[model samples]
Target: MQEKDKLNILRHSRHDWMNVVQVIKGNLQLDRKDRVYDILNEVTRRAEHEAKLSDLNTPDLAYKLITFNWQWQKFHLDIEMIGKPIDCARHEMCWLKFFDQFFEKLTEQSDSMTDPNLLVSFHLQETPYIEFDFQGGIQDMKNMQEWLAEWKVSSSCYVENIVANEQELVFVLNKK
Candidate 1:
């Protein structure tokens, strides 16, 4: 990683830590010890998840996730990873690009919704896969279909499945 990228990651990490501290402080000020404890536990859990991701030893993937969290402010994104992290250095950039484009399109499609929440999870197995659960509204199903078709043709990744409805859009991509 370049020094500049390292600095950017550090800056974002610091900002996140500041927010966590502020939340704790606010709860303390309000005499909400239970809430504070809950927040602490959640933060601890997230830290453990981060540690697990970091163990993958793929800086590009880590950087993409960190930068995504820092840059995208429109919706709440929750990421859950199961199983061990597989070394994906060979295709990390491709996967990162795919994720960026997918998230951008998801945000655009769901912009008019009142509450937009996205759940992205990855499972590492014999055939690793990533799933995106977007709880919002898809404005144009035709457009999404076309985009997915084009993406499928252009990328080496395989679309395991896609389920769309009035409430949410879910898709799974498997490494090919």
Candidate 2:
């Protein structure tokens, strides 16, 4: 990534942090202490998730996900880390390579006019797996599914697509 792109990501992250602080401040001004506490708890929960994601020992994967919002994609990306963090150093490349291709397909097949979001959750505890939950429209649905199936067949990871259609595409990947 270029230095400019790196700076842009920092700017975006800073904006989000500012928004959080503003919300908290606004609630305090309104004397809504309960709402302020709720917001703080949510912010702390999200921070914990981010810390767990960083603890996975997958720097490339972490960078890809952390900077995903800076890219030119139609959908917003949300990355979540669930359960205890596990060291995934041995499988970082495999996971990174898979997402590199998967993201391409997501952008190429997605509808640019619609506002959609993709939630990617990393289940890192026992029976670890990655979940892809996309809510949006895909232009070339068949091609996307074929690409996923091809990758699954050729790769060591196991993939199960629960739903693949125009409105949504949900799948899970687990190392074998």
Candidate 3:
């Protein structure tokens, strides 16, 4: 990462910490102890996710995720860990490629409009698949059909298939 990018990440992270502290301080001053505790709990939850993601042995993937919100994006990404964070060093390119393509498809379909948040859940269970769950601004019927015409997600050990369910689209990365 460039020094400029590192500074940017630090600036955003510091700003977020300051915001949390201010919220807690304000709540305490107002004697809303319960709310303060709730805020702390939520912060802790998010911190745990960050910690695990950082330790997942995939620097490229982790960097992309950590800096995702710092950059201007059509949608914010929320990561959910199903079981434990898997060591993806061996297949980082596979998943990263899939992620890039998925993001491109979504952004391309947006046509300059902002899309909804994307929840990417990692499941390291028996199947060990990563899911990209996106809500809106995906391809319409034509989009899906067009995407289907050229649907092929392949990597060293990752295979992907996309499907639109109701108002959302899910791209699964299966371990092969």
Candidate 4:
């Protein structure tokens, strides 16, 4: 199958899964524990299956690597930023794609880690510039290098490391 086709399937699968979750959540608001648990489990199973299908010979291997990392961040990390709007949704989309690529590289370098527990902060000023700061494991030091390299490839924004301390990595981003 074509790469775009596979990506579309993955995106669709996620959308459907979210829809199902929303429905189940709505039903559970009536205090239907049994139905909620059953639906949640089924949804999770299907999501995992679709995720596997999406991973099969994925064209953007970079995307696959960072997929779980982004999932992890979505589940565990806190993000905050301040910036004037410049294609807010598009900028976010750009970041999402870039981060998927960046985090995948980071994950590969942190092979020994089970949980890197990195603390991240983002700051976006005017135009399209933003900054990111990360703190935690030694693994992050290596990850930061790849992040910088990947950041250089983007046309949406310019990224630069303002600080690479023993415990934190700080980066700034601006419009290209």
TM-score of each: 0.84, 0.82, 0.78, 0.43
Q: Give all candidates' CA lDDT scores.
A: 0.76, 0.84, 0.73, 0.53
**Candidate of highest lDDT:** 2
Error of 1 at 155 (Å): 5.9
On the 0 to 100 scale, the lDDT of residue 158 in model 2 is: 61
Top candidate on TM-score is: 1
lDDT for each residue of candidate 3 in 1-176, tens digit (9 for 90 to 100):
69997897789999889999999999999999999999999889878787777877888888788778766787777887778777767767777876777677766664335357788877766556778777766546477646644545332444456676546666676766
What lDDT does candidate 3 reach at residue 53?
A: 76
Q: Report the CA-based lDDT of candidate 4 relative to the real structure.
A: 0.53
> What are the per-residue Cα lDDT tens digits for candidate 2 across 18-97?
98999999999999999999999987877787788888999888877876775567788888887889988887887888
123 Cα displacement, candidate 3 (Å): 1.3
RMSD of 2: 3.0
Sort every candidate by lDDT, greatest first: 2, 1, 3, 4
Per-residue lDDT of candidate 1, residues 1-176 (tens digit): 69998897788889999999999999999999999999999988777667766766668776566456677556777777798777766656667778878877777777554577888787867667788888876788778877876666555785658888787778887766
Which consecutive 10 residues in model 1 have the weakest lDDT in total? 151-160
Q: 2 or 4: which has the higher lDDT? A: 2
